[model samples]
Target chain A: MSKEEKRLEILTAAMRIMHQEGFEGFKMEDIAKEAGVGKGTIYEYFESKNDLFLEMLRFSTEQFITGLENSLATGTDLESKISNLSLFGSKFLSSHLNLVNSNISHLSLPEDSKDQIKRYWEHIYKTIESELAKAIEGGEIKPHIDLKMAASVIIGSLNQYAFKKLYGTGLPPEQIDHQAIARMILQGMQK
Target chain B: MSKEEKRLEILTAAMRIMHQEGFEGFKMEDIAKEAGVGKGTIYEYFESKNDLFLEMLRFSTEQFITGLENSLATGTDLESKISNLSLFGSKFLSSHLNLVNSNISHLSLPEDSKDQIKRYWEHIYKTIESELAKAIEGGEIKPHIDLKMAASVIIGSLNQYAFKKLYGTGLPPEQIDHQAIARMILQGMQK
Candidate 1:
């Protein structure tokens, strides 16, 4: 495998271990075993457990962002773009519920790791903000609407729904109507 | 002081300590001192630190709910009622950022305590859901709108904005326009 492919393989293995064993129970050796790689090979890619976990977070975040970009490219209008983005977000959040929960509960993670995660969130927010700006420029949404607040609200509401589905006895993630949610947000934003 | 007043005093003191020192650094002795009560006096009301913390959570939740109920009572129309509730929610959340963050990070808190907190969230969601139902019946909001999802989105969006104001350095909590947020949500929910 290519070096980049090998790194991706390691991250995938690490995510599985995190989901199965949680952050407290995570062990590097177990991850190596899961990935069919030697312990030394894992170390060569990551300096420590924390390093590996941070990389996994970054990898997942980048993957989601790429997916969102792809969705945006295919969507022709403001509502379609937002609907696609929300759907992607819902799927990503539901699938990574364990990782999100672990991040919430494991407050002892290093400051740098937390900062990195925060930066990733900011990136997502910026992406949404840019989309909203495009809608406004296209005269699809009201110019008076606060893009920053609008972006946060859209992302946050979708996250809340995804969270309820994942952790609460609410609708299953697949059953949620992403189009309906997008329509609601569009109604709120449109002139 | 009356019994109820004394209990409120203790809870207020506990909340202050939790905010200032966080959950990990909280101690009953310090709370007692802050409340100007004997250490044993605190035990008379709460069985232990965990009990006291849970009670604090319950106490705050009740106070916010009471405020929301009052808001609902005074508003003459559906839009006014929702605006009042959203404003109350935004103010309450902005003021209680520390408590919220502590709850998110302090996963070591007992399972029952966590469960109790979750129950409190459900209670709040139900309150919003009932209000939405009232609006639907009055033809103020669309009947087809899902009350559960609508409530979650309203509360979740307000929460997301409050969080950004509290932590994002974008705006101070006091500067956030609660009414604008309420108006946006009302637009989305209105028939």
Candidate 2:
């Protein structure tokens, strides 16, 4: 494999370990074996297990943004488009992504990692913001409201609900009424 | 002071250190000195720094719930009531509370801590749910809507926005225009 490809392979191994074992369960020696690389080779690429984990987080975030772009494009209108976004959120929460994010928070984040987090957030917010702007022009929603605030409402509502479900309600991902959630965000709580 | 009161003093000291220096900066001796207790006394109350921090978290959560109950009760109508809630959320995000929550997330949460988190969420969600029920009765919002979902939507929207602003947009709590946010949740994005 090319040098870059080899690095990618190691990250994938790390991700699997994280999913199966969680943050606390991650073991560098196990990751080296899983990646089919010598333990020394693993160190050559990553300074520490924490470094590899940070890289993996950045990689996954990039993947999420890319995948979101494709799924969002498949929606036929503002309503369906947003519903797709909400469903993706459900799927995201169901995965190890949220857990990983929370687990990494206590780490003394490096400046680059902080910047990456900022970028990840901005990238997602813009995707939602653009969707809202499109809906405005298409008359799916009124143009009078603040687009940023509107976007925040939709994002925050879905984000918190998904997070709470991880512990509070314990709903299965397949059983989540994502369409209703999207509708609620679009239409508000009014009758 | 009573044993319970003495423990509370140590937790408060720990919170101060966390705010000043974050999790990495927390020093047991520093807290003991701040609380006007011997290091031995701290051990008598809590087994370890992690144990002490967890107790501090739970203590703060309880305080939050009690304070919220009072502020939420002050609003005379549904609009004001919900606005009060959102504003409280803004103040909360701006405080050390959100920072403390994130900084502690990676900790291997004990069962008692897990239960505490669940209780905190349920407590908050119920508060919002009760407000919505009253609004429904007052005809401020439609009774046709699913109350639980509606509450989730409101909570999630405010939550994500506050969290993102912590890094994504960097809006000050006072400058957040929370009434508009509350209105958007009540009226939605649809014109």
Candidate 3:
């Protein structure tokens, strides 16, 4: 594999260990084994375990942003856009939210991570806010509906429903009816 | 004050310590000082520091369940019910969610705590599910909408919107347009 691909492989492996074992439980050797890399090779990708932990946060955030942008891009209108986002949210949250939240709240993280988390939230919030604005311009929904509230509704619905599914015995992410949710959200916001 | 009132006061005090200082950071004397009670008085209510800690979880969860029930009780119909719930959630989650989640995930918590959390979730889920079921029976919404999905949407929306307010620069909970959010959610679910 290419160097970049291999680097990502190690990161993913590190995330797995962290996800399963938390911040202090795993070792470098554990990550190396999980990644199918030699011990020394793991060192080449991340300077230290702390580095790998921080990178995991960055990697997860970056992955989410990319997924979020892509999710919003494919739809021509609000309903389809929300549907795609719902699907992405359901899939992405169950797999990665635990990793993200755990790392963000762990004491070992620096103050910078809190700012990163805040900025990450703001970035997603703004991205969705603009998407909603565009939808309003397109006459997909009511003109005067509070855009910030609308954005919160959309983001919140995805987060809570995904969390519910994760915590409760319910449909897997793939089986969730995203279109229904999207339709429900849009139907409410429409004039 | 009455005995029950004093007991609750102590629990609230313990929660403050736990909330500000985390699981390990506070002492019994600190809690007593926070509560304006003798340190010996704390032991009269709780067996030990661990007991106080565990009670904080139970106390917080019980408080949430009570608030949730009362919030739903004031509304005679679906729209009013959802609006009331939204207001309560936006206010309560900002204060209690971090504590509940931190305690639920803390290493010192026993496996039994996991069961309690699950039961707590299921209780709220069923409570809201039944409330929605009543709404459908009353013809406030469509008969054929997926009730489980509907329930998830409501719960998820409240959770997420509240979280957004907690993390972002936005309206304080009291100022949030809970009615708007309620309308949006119900509008989508209605026939």
Model 3 segments beyond 4 Å from truth? A1-10, A22-54, A97-111, A189-191, B1-11, B22-54, B97-111, B188-191
Candidate 1 residue spans exceeding 4 A from truth: A1-6, A20-43, A98-118, A188-191, B1-118, B188-191
Model 1 lDDT per residue over A54-109, tens place: 77777777888797787677798877886787677767765552343222312345
Model 3's chain A TM-score stands at 0.83
Candidate 1 residue pairs that clash: none
TM-score of each model, in listed order: 0.73, 0.87, 0.79
lDDT of 3 at B61: 75
Model 2: per-residue Cα lDDT at residue A142: 90
lDDT by residue for model 2 (A33-112), tens: 88999888988888887688788878888877875787579898877777776777767766644533322333457778
Listing candidates in order, what is each one's chain A TM-score? Answer: 0.83, 0.83, 0.83
In model 2, residue pairs whose N, Cα or C atoms come closer than 3 Å (at least 3 residues apart or on different chains), thus clashing, are A142-B191, A156-B156, A156-B157, A157-B156, A157-B157
Task: Name the top DockQ candidate.
Answer: 2
**Decreasing DockQ order of the candidates:** 2, 3, 1
Q: For each candidate in the order shown, give its overall lDDT on alpha carbons.
A: 0.70, 0.72, 0.73
What 10-residue stretch in candidate 2 chain A is worst by lDDT?
A99-108
Better candidate number, 2 or 3, judged by DockQ: 2
